[model samples]
Target chain A: MTTGNPGPTSGPVRSEFADDAEMTELVQMFVDELPERISQLNEAWNSADCQRLEHIAHQLKGASAGYGFSVVGEAAAQLEESVRQAEDNLSAATRQFDELVDLCRRATM
Target chain B: MQQQEQQPVLLLIDDSPSIHRLLGFKLKNEGLDFLAAFSGDEGLELAKSNQPSLILLDLNMPIMDGFETLHALKDDPETIEIPVIVLSGTTKPEEKVKAFELGAMDFVCKPFDIHELRVRINSAIRISRLMRMLELRAQIDGLTGLWNRAHFNERMGTELEAAQRGESEIALALCDLDKFKNLNDTFGHPAGDAVLQGFAAVLNAELRSYDIACRYGGEEFAIILPDTNLEQARSVCERVRVKISERVWPNYPKLSATASFGLTHIGADGRTDASAFVDAADTALYAAKEGGRNQVKVYSELPEAGDGPAKLALAS
Candidate 1:
């Protein structure tokens, strides 16, 4: 869970509202924004903007679970924690950041 | 200051658009008027203008993070009393403690249970509303339902300060029921009470919406007119005077009441304390009483000292 790496048996992650007919459009909107969020995560990491990276991860951690993407939320939480505690060690935080981006890529409606 | 009951407003301050969208959808049926702000600066502005019942503040904003924003909110007189619930993505106990120290009413970690959040929000709004009601009750007069003398004193000082600061023009008027003692002795206490109540109603009806009318004491009242000059205030007081004189008590058909008013205006250059401001209006009121029982007298119209005999305008 701390590594934020998806297990081999884990399939494309669906929202908790995947089966909720009323939430179809909202859940789809969240899923549709995944690519943008993934790009944002990469931009923050590549630019070495640890503060921005932490903010984006923090937002995802708070928002993903409500959209029924608990896996992505967990990944985001792990990345946020690593960045917060990283201090001078940037390697570990970089690893968690990449793992979160992968989770966002695999998120589905 | 009794406010008409309306749907409570819930303001969410968060940098994340997704969080705003999600909460907007989830809390749509929670019987609240929802407002959203994407940054702390925007949130602070909205809080001052709207005075929302409850605030949901996110802790991880970019420039003005939750702690800084919380500190600012608690510091401002306008937004200090508002209850805030801090929402943080991290589950650190220290963050929770810090939020509470900053005057947050409650703290909810990320991935909060929707049911729990609803219950917490309801309880906070209920408690805040009750507190406000209690505060309002303390400042209101029970007999006439107008602001009590204590509230009037406080408001007068605030209005004077604002006027001196060049923010707005202000006027004050002191009103006394002419020959009130005669009415009380002749008609009895109960009848006197009815006239006071009737006078209060006339004041309420005649004054503009922003004008504040207060029960200064027995048989006397005070009015604070913000953003008004001498002519406007005199006109308003004249209307109230006429209304009081025309009012007829059904229980006592022969009963008639008239009130004398002293009006004073303060502009941006006016350098006066609350006492002096009040005294100016009181002097005008004395002139009104001396000239005639029913009339309006402006402070500026009083004769200069040692100039001549007091040349006061008598009511036609």
Candidate 2:
């Protein structure tokens, strides 16, 4: 059922979406820092530094969505929201963090 | 350095009008023609069309940002080799790291430091120019500004390789000055130097425009004649030999120098090694030396040329 809905699956659908060029730039920037960000995020998550993770995730949230990686942005937003609550559900948070990493890897690689 | 005749094209991709104006003025003296693009899309388009040697990409933009622009620039085959320097306002620690990963060769922060930015651009241009110059120098002989021995070897190899694969006639000749050392021994080294320069000039003048003459070493030269057989090479070498023999040494009465040449033509089953071709010419050179020191010899029959007493002349 291809609904002809242009989205991430279509791989950068440049619409009256004046955002394509902007998204391209953001994606390029994100991919450029991806390895470093991935490493930093992994470390922060592992060390249970929720505040730092929240800060990183907050930035990623805005940036990922800007580049049309909505799912990644959404996941980053969730992770940050959970971190803000100081929730002790480490396992659940870790799962979301891992998914975020996967989303980032997919967006880039 | 004084400005060169041709100004290399430099692509400046920045959305800031002020920055553009300032840089346009700043780099006016650099002798580079600037192609400006305010947005990534525009810049990429320009890059595709112009193929600028260097790109100045701004990181922050509205619809398309610098990072995305960088990725697109790196991905495309035509623009891949073109170096990019990120000129962005994003000063975050993570941002700098990302810029490098995304194939930004260098980065400049805005409110750009004029000196730092100029230095980076200058360095990029310098390095690129140096690389091109080194490549050219590698192909040339340092002393005479002619092709070097390695170039000669490579070219000869290619010619022979082509000949071996097809029905092409390739003629190779080696010419050595006869009794050149005696000139150096009689006159000072300066006189010997004069002779070498004079010899090269005369050789350059005598050979056909298509033929290549390279100084092999002290008092020795090599000429490669394509689509020429051993007989043609022999004749060509004879003309050059006669011209050189008749040349009166400057300030030295009764002093004339001659060159002994060995010519060989490669046909079917032609050998490709530099050593083999050289050896054939060398054998002919020895024959020239033996048959009274001022003629061309072709390597037709090995046994009949007969062993003549080999007189070794030191290279001048």
Best by lDDT: 1
Q: Assess every candidate by TM-score.
A: 0.80, 0.54
lDDT of 1 by residue, B1-316 (tens): 6569999999999998888888888888989999899999999999999999999999989999999999999999999999999998878899999999999999998887777888999999999999989999998988899999999999999888877686577889999999999999988888899999999999888999999999999989999998997789989999999999999899988889999998877664556677877877888889999998799988777874123122211110
lDDT of 2: 0.72
Q: Candidate 2 on B1-316: residue-level lDDT in tens?
A: 1125467788998765545655775577888889999899999999999988689888766688889999999999988878888875446779889989988888876556567888899888777778767876887765566566777888887776776678677777888888889988987677777777777777777878767777787888888887776677777888898888888875777567788887766655454455666677778778888888888887554454334221111010
Model 2 chain A: worst 10 consecutive residues (lDDT sum): A9-18
Whole-model lDDT per candidate: 0.86, 0.72
Top candidate, metric DockQ? 1
Worst 10 residues of 2 chain B by lDDT: B307-316
Superposed Cα deviation of residue B34, candidate 1 (Å) = 3.4
Poorest 10 consecutive residues by lDDT, candidate 1 chain A: A1-10
DockQ of each: 0.67, 0.03
The pairs that clash in candidate 2 are A21-B63, A21-B64, A22-B63, A22-B64, A24-B68, A25-B68, A29-B67, A32-B98, A33-B98
